[model samples]
Target: MEKWAFITGASGGIGSAISLMLAQKGYHLYLHYRKGHEEIEKIKVRCEQYGIHVVLIQADLTDLDELQNIGRTISRMPDVLVNNAGLTHYGLFTETRIEDVEQLYQINIRAPFLLAQMFTPSMVRRQFGRIINISSIWGMTGASCEVLYSMTKGALLSFTKALAKELAPSQVTVNAVVPGAIEGKLLQRQFSSEELGLITDEIPMGRLGKPEEVASLVWYLIQEDAAYITGQVISPNGGWYT
Candidate 1:
């Protein structure tokens, strides 16, 4: 039998890395993105070279209707679901708008919860599944300006723990990958050299993590040997927060 992995944000930093790694592992990919079709199409073409089916779907996760319509667009249900599409907000709490909070929750939390419903039933019937939510270090430690982002990721962490227990009996494993300071263009835009240096100084490893490193952990959790591991909030943060 063949396997399928549906990864939201597959055109992005960590998502694209995960997509490539899973495609290399021989799983057909459903690369989900809201925009960035040009970037996502490149992934589809590259994954196809690995001889696995690669399909692309465009859906704005913040919109519930579009999210619900995702199931109808896919060829079949996915064995692995990577809930990775999210946006980050950086501003003082006092300056944060109510609308920003709602939109953040819509993408980071509610979308994944709804997607679990969309895909889990097939796994329950087949008795196997892997669900990995891409979280953040701020979720664990809570950052100053990123209050809303922290709230969203913290919610994802809790969701992973509770859902793992509910799905474990059905042989479906759920976990969250908490990443810290991964190398991305967005990071450059978010922080200046001094700020980035200060951030790096705090990390014991003295550097940011690579997207491939996070993908490696997700790859391991979905394997047969990892069947026993569930309900974990695993972080690849270079010993930043133990």
Candidate 2:
């Protein structure tokens, strides 16, 4: 039987990398993106070269209606679910608005929770599944200005642990991948050149991580050999965080 992997935020750097890797591995993809139509299209075209089915799913995870619609859009339940869509708030906690908090919770917490509810029952029945959450280093160690983002990601870490135990009896696995300072448009947009330089200097490895590096860890966690590795929080931060 063909495998299906559903990845949210499939247009972002890490998301696209995961999608491509899975496609090359022969899994049909359900690629979800809130926007970034052009970028997602490029990923779709590239993945199709692997001769696997690629379905584009667009949904604003903040909206319950749209989020629910994603379940209907996909043809089958995914054997692997990558909760990678995230929104970050980069301001002092005091300066954070209610709207920012809501969006953060919606995207980073609620959507993944609901997606789990929608998909995991099928996984449990099938007796195999991989749930990989793309979390952050800030989620592990709090960040000064990104209080809300950190909280939401920390929630995912907890979710991964709890759900792993819940699904382990059925041979399903849940894990969180915490990444640090990856080189991407999101990081570049949020930090200045000098700030990024300082950030890179703080890492013992002396460089920001590549998207493929993170994707490699994710690729491992979803494999049959990794079935024993559930409820673990693994970080590929280049020695930036323990």
Candidate 3:
């Protein structure tokens, strides 16, 4: 039997890692991206070398109508759905505008909820499925300057817990991955060299985690070995937040 997985933000760092890792596991991938066809094109080529099928799904996740279009292009219902698309705003709560807050929620929290509504029915009918949401440490412990991002991610964590219970009876499992100080553009863009050093030093591992490490966890959850695990907010934070 073949397994299909749909992943949003597939052109980006973490999403690409997850897509490639799943391809190596022999899962057909539907890689979703919001912008720039070129990035996913590279990833698609990489996945194909593993001899697995990879499809590209493009959607402006903030647009509800566009998000609905994602599943229509792909013929099969995915056995796995990874909601990895999100936006974050870092600043004083008072300095942030109302619109940015709304946008953050739309991408981080709303899109996942909408995608679940679209995909979960077939999953329940099939009696097997896996859903993994890429969450952050800020979601678990609120960040001082990133108040808006924290709120939406916190809601995602709550959403994972509640939905896991509802879907588990049908053999569908939902989980979230909480990552910390991941080596990515976001960290580079957000912090200075000295700041990054301070952050890395604080981590017990003394380094940033590779996106592949995060991808591996998502791979593990879909296996029969992890069937007993659901509704859990598992962190791959290198003991940073434990």
Candidate 4:
């Protein structure tokens, strides 16, 4: 049987890149998106060229019940689960709204935990699974005006490490990819070219990491060669956090 991967935030950016990469590697995909049906359809069309089965599931990760329902609806448990759906809130902590904080936590922390819980049993039974949580550089090193987002990601990092140990004996690997500033709609909206250049210059590599770069690392971590590696937070941040 073809291995299957479940990728949240599969509509664009890093998530979309990872989906395409995995499809080329011959993995069937279950893509989860919040509100980008048009974009998802485009990805589905592209994925068909690779001759991989593409399934689209639209559910806001903030709603844990909906996520569980989606999980149950899928025909088979995924061989790999990429928890890439997350929301970011920027502003002084004092100015951030409680509702926004809650929403961020819901998507970043709660949803991943619940989805993992729902799907992991089947993986354990099969003795084969890969869980990759797409975290952030801020999650490792806290960022100003991004306190809540950092907290949730930090929690995810901790979850990755702890769960990796728990599932290792079952041949399941859990890890996180901590990415630096990538060229994407989200980063462009937050920083001007000048500001982005300054940020990039601060990195040892003097360049923003690309989404495809991160996806490549994820691709490696899910392979059979990576079986011995688990419970690790691997940062591909262009030497930004060293």
Question: How much RMSD separates candidate 1 from the native structure?
Answer: 0.8
Please report the TM-score between candidate 2 and the true structure: 0.99
Q: Tell me, by lDDT, which candidate is best.
A: 2
TM-score (C-alpha, index-matched) for candidate 1: 0.98
lDDT of 4 by residue, 11-38 (tens): 9799999999999999999999999999
Of the two candidates 2 and 4, the one with more favorable lDDT, higher being better, is: 2
lDDT for model 2, please.
Answer: 0.95
Whole-model Cα lDDT per candidate? 0.94, 0.95, 0.92, 0.91
How far residue 108's Cα lies from its native spot in candidate 1, in Å, is: 0.3
lDDT of 2 by residue, 1-242 (tens): 99999999999999999999999999999999987999999999999999999999989999999998888877799999999999988898999999999999999999999999899999999999999999999999999988999999999999999999999999999999999999999998998999999999999999999999988999999999898999999999999998
For every candidate, C-alpha RMSD to the true structure in Å: 0.8, 0.7, 0.8, 0.9
Worst 10 residues of 1 by lDDT: 180-189
lDDT of 1 by residue, 5-87 (tens): 99999999899999999999999999999889899998898888899998889999988899999998887999999998889
Q: Rank by lDDT, descending?
A: 2, 1, 3, 4
Q: How does candidate 1 score on lDDT?
A: 0.94
Q: Which TM-score value belongs to model 4?
A: 0.98
CA shift at 46, candidate 3, in angstroms?
0.3
Task: For candidate 4, give the lDDT of residue 137.
Answer: 88
